[model samples]
Target: MSIRRAAIWSFASQYASFVIQFATSVIISRYYLLPADVGLFSIALAAAMVVAIFQDMGISRFVTGQPEMREEHLRDYAAVAVGLGWGIAALVAAGAVPLARFYGEAGLAKVMLIIAGSYALFPFSIVPSAMLTRALDFRRLFQANAGSALAGAVVAIATAANGAGPAALAWGMVAATLARLILVMAAYPVLPRRPASLEIVKPMLGFGGSSFVISLSGAVGMRCQDLIVGRMLGVSATGLFTRASALAGQLTTLMVGAINSVFYPAFAKKRDAGEDLAAPYLHLIACNTGITWAAAIGLALAAEPVVHLLYGPNWADVAPLLRWTALAELFFVAMPLQMDVPILLGRIKPLVWINLLDTFITVVILVVASFWGLEAAAIGRILTGAIWLAIYASYIPRLVGIRYSALGTAYLKSAAVALAAGAPLALSRWMSGAGAEMGFISLLGLSLAGVFCWLVALPLVRHPFWQELRLALSHMAKLRTTQA
Candidate 1:
């Protein structure tokens, strides 16, 4: 398939997941799950993600390395994937009770164990999903993901209506994975059979092994906050925070994750073929930064209204936290680009150190935040993002042989333009009262004011934005010219 088609497929799948997730989160947070229940479910999901770190084994990338890979290689990868997943799932299950005890929630153990068991089913889908990406057959993968998300949401809603509470959340995952597995298996013609020879095992183990460490460290760095928050703040607070983060992350994942998915396949191919990496690398960074910053800022600004509209007033506490967290994600938008570079370039060692540093800082912040408040945890999150950005400043240039100054300029230019646009919105918010009704008239006023400020100021203050503005307009003009 063409690159555009692959991107469109990935985007459609992401949208499908987003719609179901948004609806479920809205309903479950407001009506079904209590604060404590949300906390426990968040904790359970976090633990499962930690296990997934090691379980993944980076065989996805390894599979892509094989140019003429046969059905036999697929089988062996499948066997390895199953074995690894089972081992991690078993470990998580074994520790579930202790984890619950540590968190002072007796039922958390069972919750975690149930969620951990869901990992065993994950391996059944991994190879097929990876193969689909490697083959650029996103349509099939999209079907699997869309099917899983839809089925999961339906099950969660049904079970919650039956009064399952947080357990319904876990059950949703189980149902989704099952749905995804069924659809993905059906999408492919080949069926799982016996394992192949151990020939490819060494290289697979070597490449995927470090990836496992990176995934484990990265998972801990990312979700260790969930564990700490659940223990310190209790389930309800944790749940609220998780829901907030999930909403913010949903936006990031939709944009950054979609691009990263496409980036890996496209650039990994270029890297494999000894293609000139500089242009693709620079293009990816520019595209990623522009899209990510715009979305993150837009989300942060819109967080209050969005939370009020979707989750209702009961979740009022989440708005500030979501806004702060979304701002932090502006720094993190560049993170996916940093990570994909090393993985694709086979230069993952830097990530080991980077992730370790990130984990230490993240753990410190989360623990300290727990002592003070969840708001502190949010601050810690922003700090963690700053650390990632700092590391990228030093790291990306070295990896690609580009000067740090050039990198700095690109980021600053984008930052300047975004700030130029965003400053007016903030001013308007400061002037407007929260009590004011957000009606069509008010929205139209704000929209018009924002556009007026952006259009007038952008042309005068930010030359780079003006240039891009002109280029975009010129392209459209050219299209018009062609039509005429």
Candidate 2:
């Protein structure tokens, strides 16, 4: 499949998963689980994720980015992947006790133990999944992911309702991983062979070592807030922060995350073909910023009603947190393909340093702000995001020869669109009295108005995204006609 087609399929799959997961979160948070329950699970998952970074150890990227490889090479990578996966699983299981003791939560140990089981199954699927990705066979990928997400959602919801608490979340993840493994096996039934020579492992390790460090740093940066909140402020605060972060992430994931899954291979192909990446990269920035900015602005404007309606009164504090996170996400989506572009260009060293810098900055800010409270922590993220954008701006131009002026121009129309789109909701909130009680219907109506205004503003601003959208629709039409 073409890159565009692959991205479309990936987006559709992720969108479906997003909806299911969103609903599941609502049900579990509102009825089945307490804040502490969710918090405990979040903490356990966060710790497991730090260890889980080593599970794939860049093997998937190695497989996907290579122009060609023999069956032997594939088997070699697969064997190494399996070894890393089991090793990480063992590490996590062993660490569970100390992690739980440090956090002073006995349940976390159980949750971590349950989560560790999923790591062992990860190796079984990673190679096949990478092969599918390299071939642009996103349809099968979609099937695997969507099926697993559905299965996991069901398991999580059922178990949560049955009062399994955080264990439900852990077991649900295992189920998802198992389902994905089964589907991937069905899709690409290639068995891994043990490597006979050390040569295969050497080169992979060299590339993978840098990738692992980058992944580790990024994970730590992202999850450090959860650790700080859980340890310093307690589980309930961590739960609230996690919920807010998840809600804000939904918009970014919907807009850019799926496209990113396709972009790495796409960029690698371009690099292999000796094509200049500046034009495509700039276009991506414009389009991503346009859509994401509008969504972020809308979410921020409607934060109060959204939190209340979806998660009930107990989660009201999450609204402000969501609003701040939404703002940070705007900057994030501005450079959705940042890491992919550099990695594709074989410039992993600078990227690793940048990630380390980001992790250090994030942890420092989050730690200092944690003393104030959750809202302060949320605000610190926005500050960190702005600073990171500046940091990225300094390096990206030097690395890729893209002008900063071009990036600023790309953001201009989107910023205008966001401001215009958010005006109606802002007005509604003001007119209804800032503290006025509004029902779900009222909030829904205002949200519709905001969307309508956003659509109207698009053409008025002469946004480049409008043309892109038209071109996409035209392309889809032609594809349909050709298939017919």
Candidate 3:
């Protein structure tokens, strides 16, 4: 039930959920609908995300960051969050018609309404979820996520088989959310026990106010690409870009979420106790950066065949975009340390402003690049991520008093390792008839080549990562020896 064990379990669940979701997407996109339907579904999903942004002001984050939590506080915060969720969902639902009209898609109004209305239920689930996280009880989370993903996948596949198109997408998401809610509620012992009250509302909002702005700005910034693409190049292009970006986002989210779920609670507790917490913070940065580099490189090298096999020939166009966006994962993966750590340390104002700046710049870039089409828009996404990472890296060291030089060196080495692994795969594919066949054999061969190249080159770049690996092994060995 410790934070470390919680992180491990959450990571395991994420992996399982990811596999199920990825397999489901492939089956649905290839066997059921045209690329156009996929595009519209992406838009509807983006609208859902935007509406969900205004739901609860991250009160659950506030709760998790608390050093000490009580059942009364849980009930109070839950009531406030649920009240806010319903209020926001209702307002957005009311505006759905006008918003869809503005977008020239009256049909989307109904879809948006359905997606937005879910926000009403979402906040009610947050307190139980946060309580589990605060207790480092991610076994419940893992179970919930895995079960939800499997059940949702089955529902989606069935709907898609029945020719439901984008409605299938909506059904799948709703199913997943409902399943997650049910599982979490069943696993959690405490439930919200009170009605809405102002007394429970004040502290939650006070603590999470800056987090609210940051979360809102971040949502706007993150979805700026979809907004611009949907407006400029049409839904089809937006769909392709969004689908590719989603894959990369999943990987980034898994790493950042795993770390954040553990580090935030630990960091907040340490800060509350006035402890000097330098080592754990640095260790997290190193571990995340290293893991991110590995995933990005591996993905970048195998993007073409990976896309061909995973998404079918119709989605082949997304391969290049996926590669470009995957690089952003490297930068985004370190986000937990650079962003969440500041919040845990109570430096909320700066975090809010930083996110605001990021959103402003992102909106400008996204709008401008939309004129150039989807490829340019994809590049814009990468550029925005790189700029944000640079800004964070520059300021965070001074804010936290960590040696920036050490962090910088680690990042540089990680990037080098990534490039080394990726370059060979790119070259090998180019030399292998430019990956034109799109057959099973070709894809399998390319995958093997990529794996071989990655394995051969990985250990050559840095001994430090390998040393850490060995240290982990040694520690495991010692633990087993003690147990015996």
Evaluate model 2: give its lDDT: 0.85
TM-score for each prediction?
0.89, 0.96, 0.91
lDDT of 1 by residue, 1-484 (tens): 8765687688788888888878887888778777678788889888778867877788877776554567666777777888888888898888888887787788788777778768878887778888888888888888988889999999998998898878888889989988998998887633445565556577788888787888788799888778888878777788778877887788888765766787778877777787876656665565566555665775676667667766667777787788889888888876456766777776788777776786787788779877888777776778878887887767776777766666666676556545645655566677874422355455545545655655665555443445545776786798899999
Evaluated at residue 376, the lDDT of candidate 3 is 81
What lDDT tens digits, residue by residue, belong to model 3 across residues 178-245? 88889988987445556566666677778777777888888888765676677788777877988789
User: By lDDT, who's the top model here?
Assistant: 2
- Pairs of residues clashing in candidate 2: none
Error of 3 at 467 (Å): 4.8
Task: Say which prediction, candidate 1 or candidate 2, comes out ahead on lDDT.
Answer: 2
State which candidate, 2 or 3, has the greater lDDT. 2
**Model 1 Cα RMSD, 1 decimal:** 3.5
Worst-scoring 10-residue span by lDDT in model 2? 429-438
Error of 1 at 287 (Å): 1.9
Residue 326 Cα positional deviation in candidate 1, in Å, after optimal superposition: 0.8
Ranking by TM-score: 2, 3, 1
